[model samples]
Target: MRTGGKLAWGFILLLGIVHWDFWLWSDRTLVFGFMPVGLFYQVCISIAAAIGWALVIKFAWPKDVERWADEGRDGGGEA
Candidate 1:
């Protein structure tokens, strides 16, 4: 596995850990006086997920897939 693969796996594990709902935050505790603490935490998780996906796409996307796409675009013939 390459660096990207390791990063992807690490990010996945982080998400799994965040999804555990064992926090002691009370329901009455609100973030920004509107969103509940749990909701705020989930929102943060979502943002992290989006960023993680971007990183994975940039660094972890299969090189073979990119090569295949280029080959198809070039029609497998000399320029």
Candidate 2:
């Protein structure tokens, strides 16, 4: 994959890892306590992280992904 695509994928994976429910489980009590702090804060953080990573990939490595895709197409030519 191109650099940008790889970066974007990495960021997406990271977002998934960060927002995994396992981490949130520990804070569930706080989340359901009606304080609206723990869950809300985590949601905000996850959203911000996703947006930031997406922007980084969109701007930093777009060409790399395109090149990688082109290479794949060339290598997969039909017989």
Note the residue pairs that clash in candidate 1: none
Best by TM-score: 1
- TM-score for candidate 2, please give it: 0.41
User: How close to the true structure is residue 43 of candidate 1, measured as C-alpha lDDT?
Assistant: 88
Question: Candidate 2 on 1-79: residue-level lDDT in tens?
Answer: 6676667677767776776556556564555567555577678767878786776757565566677766747455565
The whole-model C-alpha lDDT of candidate 1 against the native structure comes to: 0.78
After superposing candidate 2 on the true structure, give the runs of residues whose Cα lies further than 4 Å from its correct spot.
Answer: 28-37, 49-53, 56-79
Q: What is the lDDT of residue 12 in candidate 2?
A: 69
lDDT, candidate 2, residue 30?
52
Evaluated with lDDT, which candidate comes out highest?
1
